[model samples]
Target: MRRPSLPAWAWVALAAHALFVADARAAARFDAATRVFRLDGERVTYAFGINEAGQLQSLHWGGRLADGDPLGPAKSLPSHSSFDLSASITPQEFPAQGGGVFTEVALKVAYADGNRDTVLRYVSHTLERDAVTVRLRDIALPLEVSLRYTIDPGTGVIGRSARIENLGRTPLRIDQAASAAYTLAPQDDYRLHHLSGRWAGEWSLQQRPVSEGASVLESRRGSTGQQNTPWFAIDRGGSSGEDSGPVWFGALAWSGSWRISIDKDPLGAVRVVGGYNPYDFAYRLAPGERLDTPVFYAGYSDGGMGGASRLLHRFERERILPGGGKPRLRPVLYNSWEATEFAVDEAGQMALAEKAARIGVERFVVDDGWFGARNSDKAGLGDWSVNRAKFPNGLKPLIDKVHGLGMEFGLWVEPEMVNPDSDLYRAHPDWVLNFPERPRTPARNQLVLNLARRDVRDHVLQVLDALVTDNDIQFLKWDYNRNWSEPGWPQLAPEDQPKVYVEYVRNLYWILGELRRKHPKLEIESCSGGGGRIDLGIMALTDQVWPSDNTDPFDRLSMQDGFSHAYAPAAMMAWVTDSPNWVNRRETSLDYRFLSSMQGALGIGANLNHWRDADFATAARMVAAYKQVRATVQQGDLYRLISPANGSPRSATLSVSPDRRQAVLFAFLHSQSKGMQEPAIRLRGLDPRQRYRIARLGGGALPEAMPAEASGAYWMEHGLAVPMRGDFQASGFVFEAK
Candidate 1:
């Protein structure tokens, strides 16, 4: 990987003053007696705060009630609220503020009517040399929403960005968001706009592969609600536009605010910023850090996903690429289903790993069958240990074999669920989560682990900790297969069972947090029976998620599109030719298969040993081309090239790396009609100034182009020749911009 040079403007700021030009504005009050931050708005009063480190606090929404409204006398939904609050720092984490200048910040919400409400939030603060941990113990009212503001390390401006977690019992469900009045004391222009593009590259875990898969695709229908993706740049009391600058104010929680801001950059570009990277380095909030005082930033992006990235880098210009480096992973790799699946003998397992390594892969992840009991997916899940029957030689040797092949080894673990037939379940029935005297239910041949139990938590910690300490596992695909529909925590009292939901989630966080801390090099991925639990809430914990189990290229066209609404292409686990098309009725060609997977994390989920020589040759080229322009795909502004075809030759393209340096364009052609002409689709998200080298996988002519505009492609005025053709399934093209 190569390092990117800092912008020349940033170099100038490096030599400029960093603290003397600090500005402070006081509008809301932080109250010590009440322990809540209060922000007064034109229509309502916003008062709220959090103290729970890994736990949750409460939110109260009240204002002058109308006579006709029922909320005041009897109960109604308009003016009442009780939200469970969480921290960047887990609440239960015993924090010791080796005392200094640490301050606390939070969000406050109030209801005015059914269609109106008021919101007040704080921003994440910047990091300084004299920084130390300070857990937010309590939040009393009138304690003006503020943090110990520090001068930006690179730009000298006082900056703060934080995340407010809504860990309530039921999802609060945000409809339309409106800002009351805000204190516009800092900048003369209170201009707020919609931002576009990628985010600043300064976050602790800004995994490019994950970010690319984590986009929030626009919603046309209402089956799946819109994703609460946080953006930077929106002024309270001003008209919203498409321009951006610095996001210096506002204190809002993450789930509660989908309407973030877009600030003005020196240029007219609607630059985006935020997401807790400004104030701290990329260290897991472990041993020495405070627990409860955590936060996340939501910005405003007009260019949708593209806008968000632009706003992110605006404020975080200096540390965009921490070491200012180039990205390597393009979310492309191969994963085996059995490294942790039903018991498989060491010889059989080694064969699979060996084959995967030989298939032009950077990561060879062993999935489920490698750990626990006898052969079959029905046995050991939470056991987290090697079953001698399958791997007599132990995991270290297997990992060593993978390492010797020069490929990264990844393992699987369902830390939050277990199988009743395992040792952990047999010895401790209490560890199994179920209703009293109720028949046990099953999903994926496994039972849910009662994470709320202290003993159960201890067992999980022990198992995971050892997995990391024992083998040379570089990545752990942590999976949670079900939702918390049946609220049952055996250990908690009947009355306290309601509290179990929050507790279980907290314990899970604790376990993951501890693991990341103990093993900083550990790469964690969270998968929930495939996209079952995809949301911003989980992104804070894991890097990427398995978008779905249906790896069929045809089915993925819609599934992946649906997932893009709230996630990026980087977070989606796309496999190249996994088994057969799980949906529809046809064998998808490998070229189409590779093109299908190219849109997201590229991986091979099928038996690599079954691949033909031609397949190997094609796979090698795709991987090489992928590495060449992954940064453009993962971090550059994204644009949809072709409209989705219901059943005809469906095709689309994503032009990644738009600064004109390098770009990757992918297109997939589905179905070949007897008398139809092959579609030639024009590309999107490209720079007209930079010429690109276009190539095909098997063999085809390169796509020609006309002209483009800042808004979008002008050539498509109509579509072009399809990127690929065959079983009418999938195919991709590589367009490298230089």
Candidate 2:
């Protein structure tokens, strides 16, 4: 008898089986021999242990914890002085403002008895399949704090939060409360990476070295303002590049103003604390009442900044976004904001809709100016009525025409604001958020509505609900365009005046919930003058976000890069608008614009009426091609091969399908210098042994060295070289397994 022959896949399966076992053991494991608990994903691990003092100690996070005794005690500490007496050297899991240390505390609570001391000591802990809850109590006060840690099995993202309960007869005032406190072993060379921008320049990446003092990244302008995003990354030794090194990162899930502080002690130890901005913030908790902080998600990666981003992307898609049913694919939408601006009308919108449908647009959104006296940004806010002058028969005609063209219809609205010139404001001047005697400060001629008021909240909800129900609206671009100047709610008591900041966001969330409950089929996009309100809180209800008001493809490249660090591509709505470009006036090719926008949730904001025949033909073809790879690009693992920040003329990105059968690559050349050579573009996340067929999407001309077919291993190892030249040029390709 002949020996049985095995197929090639048999060996592949054997190799994968070992990986599966290793992954399972490291995913979330407790080593009884070492008395340590570890949480691990494919490329990272986090380990910690409880010490003799019953406090969490020896916290270490990095690539993998395969060494011995990773849960050892801290070997270094700052000298204790008569002025600041912080004695014990072990890293704290959650420090409170009592005795025991002068380092920054994560929680600060005040009692009705006028005592402001709070010393939390660990009492007990319980571990579940995906979560662990640690119980702590003040040394004297009758209060209990529970710290919850939940690790996502797929992305290894640790979701952290705190719940504080008043176990005493009297009430307690929480002066400051953070969701989690993360401590790192003594290291002096760590660098902090954060995002900072304003209005049209949101989410611009910024980096600085971590010094001995505290570095605070916060947003105090009501919503998650354009000033600072509540996410950060720490890279030690300034050596972490886009694709390699040790990087620890985190993001808060609150839509209201937030704060994250990184405090580096004199001894080189670092503690990261994050949650709602406690500045001018105080929460009153009566007896038996509990306050829960928003989720603060943190993760570690050895694969550098890119790896940390990929982990976040996966977690956001699988766990954060809400659709309540089958996830909808983001359509190639055509927005009329740039096309018509404040001059939109029924006939004008119908003409654009005809051209949009011809170019294979899936959604047609009529932007501003279709409402009551809204000919400009100076008036007509907070009025949800259709303008009879613009549309004599209301929105039914435009809605019918859009549906007839086989496209979904969307409307733009800034429901959280009111213009002083509008009838709504005249009828209820006190409805705006303002002090009784303070002069109202208007931005873009608008004031924020007091959403915290019950009547105001109910009215906004009712108006939105009626619009969706009556007009058969499928989508809404909900916008909040201004920051709060004097956010005073006279309706509430003086003690509750500060409550406006918190209640306004809570009311916004309530309105969103009610809207979703009524119109399950309707999708919403959160846009605050663009990207101002993008965060985990709003993301839970909205389908997508407009990343910026500046849509210049070059500017968008960096903007989109910074956005992907904390968000998924599926939720990033990128648009290809008319060029010269509206923001920068940098002339770019039509293909370049489309390719840039295709990197995320694709949309077109260019005026179709002004497009030439050739432009329309190219757009139609590109739109069809985008639909073919939309799922892979939106949901696949992202690999930042080349960054645009390095001053190099070229930038490259790759995305691989989850099943490992297909991949897409996007390369851009901002401006090539003389005698520069085309760089090699490597691929990732593929079955190395399998053969794949390569096809170009829209790269002007193919490189002379291009091959039609190659093995995945060869593609990843040797890489493919594409010919690139000229300023503002882009190239794209798709690889499919044969």
lDDT for each residue of candidate 2 in 1-738, tens digit (9 for 90 to 100)? 974587776655555444434555545554433335567755556767655555555467666556343554333234466654543334677778777667777788889888988877778667666677878898778999998888876767888899999999988888888998887777767889998898778878888888888999998888998889989999877578777888899989888879999987556678898987987788787799888888999888877898889888877887788853334679999999998999999999999999999989999999999999999999899889999999999999999999999999999999999999999999999999898998999999999999999999999999999999999799999988998878888986676577777788889999999999999989999999998998888898999999899999988888888888888898899998887997878999889998899999999999888899999999998999899999888988888787787576888788888897889888999997886987688887778999988888753445677888999999999899887777888989989999
lDDT per residue (tens digit) for residues 89-140 in model 1 = 1111111111110111122222122221222223222223422112222232
The deviation in Å at residue 551 for candidate 1 is 0.3
Model 2 error, position 562 (Å): 1.6
Off by over 4 Å in 1: 1-297, 304-332, 338-343, 645-649, 672-680, 697-731
Best by TM-score: 2
lDDT of 1: 0.47
Best by lDDT: 2
Off by over 4 Å in 2: 1-58, 63-89, 324-326, 699-701
